[model samples]
Target: MTKTSAVFPQPAPGSKPTPRVYTDEQKSMIEELRQYALSLLLPETDSYHPNERRWIEEPECPARYMRAAKWKLDDGKRRIKGTIEWRREYKPDLISAEHVKIENDSGKILLNGFDYDGRPIITMRVGRQNTQPSERQILHLIFCLERAIDYMPEGQDSMLILVDYKSATLKSNPSISTALKVLHILQDHYVERLGRAIVTNLPMLLNFFFKGIGPFLDPVTREKMKFNPNLHELIPDEHLEVDFGGKFDYEFDPDSYWEQICRHAGVNADGSRFEPEWKRTQMPQQEQEESPKPVDSETSSTAPDLVADDDDVESSRAPSVQLPRASKPVSVKGGSSGKEGVEVIGEEEPNVLVASA
Candidate 1:
């Protein structure tokens, strides 16, 4: 199979870059929907919701909510409301950039380049992530997800999570209960924001872990989960890091991003309020657009040939914040942490994995 490049336009040497231009009609539609969503999120007559209050009011924020709703007025309004409610319950703002000290956890989480669809690619090395406290890690993950909101390309409301299972041992795999909880928060609270996922370097033992949770997922969400050793199946070479056979190497200094957050919020390490940098000029919401490279296409190449069968294990899914559903049950055994690295589900162990009641 051949590869197709993304449509991100490149600037030729000595040529000035082209500025992105939105038509007047396009701008009006975006602004109008954003304002409508705001009405639902924050009404004049009612007291303020915490989520509404804590939310960064960047202009693009509304555009993202609208895109998540596919631009349907009613649906968009409902989506925004749900997110606000979820934020209040989850209290993501409290996690802030400082709480997640990432000096040792870089292997656990990272935001990489964009995929073919222009969605930011976030890779999770599960083996690497398992070292941290589950709840802390989950909180940081949510915080990063929110942080990505500021950097997403236009028209993309979601991003991709690449769960890299390389070097995964029984001790390093995330506990079933903990993994389920993380998934629930993402699906139930975040909702409709996940674009897709690539579960790379899967070991056979954990196949049962994925299989056990498969029953809860709808076919559409499940279908989005692609199991492949090769990253090229979902993204182009230029967008990938050398670890996955791409041009660039994945290098993220967690503190650098955290400091960015600190600067944006205008707070010191102690978390007291101070004047922010962008505040001197325009608030972040009205500032210049992000300068991420475009996702160009290589249409002439053949499609990538996947080594693994898509049906062998359960697939990944996108965000779907807190939708109502009846209880569904399923079970699969996990590897033990002992010498053999196999975990047998004992009587004391959990037998059912049901995300919703």
Candidate 2:
């Protein structure tokens, strides 16, 4: 099937980026939220809730909450207070690699790459999921979400989510309950943090999956969802994965990638936090020339017979679904040191294959 391109007007080259100008009323609401946050008495111990106070007092965080509450001071205060209490229970910041290592075994969720707007990208490959539906899976997701939020640089408040359903069938889709839980967490605590969500290679059968979670999604979150758009326009070729028709050919290595994530989080094997070297280490580097030519959106084409087979021994038993045929064939490569490779088969189906490094 031909992929349709979604055109977002790109800012003119070298144009001065617009700055956020808030009105006086909004400013007052933000200040009120900040004051409310400051008045709370959190535990002095940082281990259980590291950076708790600082996060509440973060200059941009209160504004984000206020905007999420539609600038209503009371509503925003309730949201802020609720989130503070929820963090104490959820401990998203304290979720460690050891706590969710098993969930990472299949490399299902990854925090890598950036979008054209420089928002950090979190790619979730549902077909690669190895575990049954459980609360641990949610913890794993919260861990990755925290890491993504921490990776955000100044001036960037949102993240880009790429949910790839390449080898996914109806059986592999997340349960409605789990989906609703995810929706609640994202829409509530992580308010206004989704820059955009691009759901690619989605199977028709999985349309019901979205329909199941549709009602719980905030209208704004629903609007951020994009389906099978030309990803090249949204992500730079260097950062885009080859699995999604870009130059970055990243294979998933569960072991090494997990270590990379742990090191970034500065957590010990037992789930305790430690001071990392703070070196310039990053997610697996993209191995390409200093500057690679970007793919021309107008001239780009995909393999007509390109297909991803559910070759995972664990997920092989789950039946696959027939997928729309593409225009060009993509060569799949396996990774070294526990990196799982993608095996492209005939034009049978496109399942959940995450294109992340």
Candidate 3:
């Protein structure tokens, strides 16, 4: 197994440095989970190729699953299993930014420059944008996470996410279930990926979502979370988006980003609209990024399409989280399968899954 520094210097100059590397026992568990997860995620279809099989073995990939599992084989196994199920259902790698692109959502969730640690700066305008349905929004977020992960080099395996809260309201706040799931995925699946989560211009109504979210955060991530009333403190000017008090005028361009993602995912855009090309690298390609195009009037994914009734859904057998749209006290709906009722549990924290249905 390889090692990289995933922790950052604390805001307190005298604070002790934290542990970021996986221990030997954890490493062993990671290897085990990797072997098992590979079996689950890799389909014996015609699409399977020798080089394609190498993705799960990428240096940091397995280790991430272990850390999310907190070094427990059982936990790691479940995380991998659940991820495999989600992957099949959402088919994330096949999902191109072009296919889910919202012209207006470009700024709502834009990646501008690199941070001091050299991680990409991803600033999301939660107050202004609603790009996709809760589930698709989560999927798009996963896509962004994929891009962020692909581009990061070994030592700098993270990104700085600034959730802009300028004009936030209760209605605008994403459903608690989706927010929890997204945060859970980030902490668990990505491992040491959030360098800083600067939440600027917070609204009072947004407090409930944050409160429910408090229990799920990783210690390191929780420590890194800050309410930056002013973005100038944590985010550098070059990496900061103009709307969020930074110099850069960043916008999300599906075409450009999709091209980059295609190359990263080893795919291409041909006569088929989106073609899977084997030439893409699993990691970030060292290329110059051009300025993204301007955003438009497109609407984001609505809650009805993705936000699920999480209250009735237990957190134990959560093979797949039902992402129904945002509403108060969700109505009774069919279980995950709609026929055979599967007991679902959301043991999502620091990104670990306890079991699968």
Candidate 4:
């Protein structure tokens, strides 16, 4: 009896699954949602609470806010026009001992109160703190507050003048030296575009005061206020002189300058400069004379013959070969002569050979 052996099938090894691909419509929808989410939920803005006094994050936040605010303001109107009003209020002194308040059974009173009332009175004090407004926040607050006041008509002229004066003072003040240094640091360390935008927009903030809000100021006061001449220009011309040492003087022929710089650095601007002049240094006089000739097949074939003729002439002039003696006897009848001799033989007709020998 013959028995068949059992056969087993092997399982296939697992392969990696392919990533799912989204359709164009799905991708477009996803991008749209991402943009909307980014606009609405800016992480930088979300980090700061509304009540916080710091405005350093305003550079990213105010732009988004202004866009929305402006859209809302101009939705129904053809040209929305308005004016802004600003004013400076003296902060209450908080550092003096007299500024401190004590609460009594009848009322709250300053320690140095001239007259004390029996009614409840709250004391409010203000003073300079270690923390100051960020430059970005200061500009944002100025812009937003100006916009807010512009939307409203009350005290428009007065506020415009005040904002301009305040901005000018800030621009000229030495107190913000640290902030300016920080701005420079930011420019160096952060994305260059962002730093440049921030620096550039600082002037725009001033321009906004002078141009956008300046019109509302009283004619006499407007004449008194002067802006830095450079403030209005976005990018200065090459010939223009900026108050700072920085100037724009770009080379018209940068390639020429590059060549000169490379030369000064002890580097060849082009490879040909370092290459030996073969015509002047390495080439023989004969080679230089013959270098320009074109070598076709006829010329190339004749070149070997010319070289061989030169070699033959040189060999003939050499003292190595012994010449045959002219006085030697000659034999012409197919007979040998018993002396050193030369012989000549006549040609004969050719004979055919048989295949079988």
Each candidate structure's TM-score, on Cα atoms with residue i matched to residue i, is 0.58, 0.71, 0.60, 0.15
- Candidate 1, backbone clash total: 28
**Candidate 4 per-residue C-alpha lDDT over 106-198 given as tens digits, one digit per residue, 9 for 90 to 100:** 111101100000111111111101112333222212222222221221111111111111222232322323323323222221111110010
Each candidate: what lDDT?
0.47, 0.58, 0.47, 0.20
In model 1, the runs with Cα more than 4 Å from the true position are: 1-80, 130-134, 251-357
Greater TM-score among 2 and 4 belongs to 2
Q: Candidate 1 lDDT, tens digit per residue, 83-142?
A: 666654445543434444442244466654565555667677766643334344555566
lDDT of 3 at 226: 62
Task: Give the per-residue lDDT of model 3 (tens digit) for 1-357.
Answer: 122112111111111123356568767777887788667655555342222254566776666666556667787787767655554444444444453444223345554455544566666766655443434455556666665655464455567676677775555566666666676666655665666666666666656567776777666666666664345444455344566655544444544444434343333222011212322223344442221121111342312244422111122111211122212221211111000111122222222111000
Residue 112 shift from truth in candidate 2, angstroms: 0.8
Clashes of each: 28, 17, 25, 2
Candidate whose TM-score is highest: 2
Better of 1 and 4 by lDDT: 1
State the number of backbone clashes in model 3: 25
**Which regions of candidate 4 deviate over 4 angstroms?**
1-174, 178-357
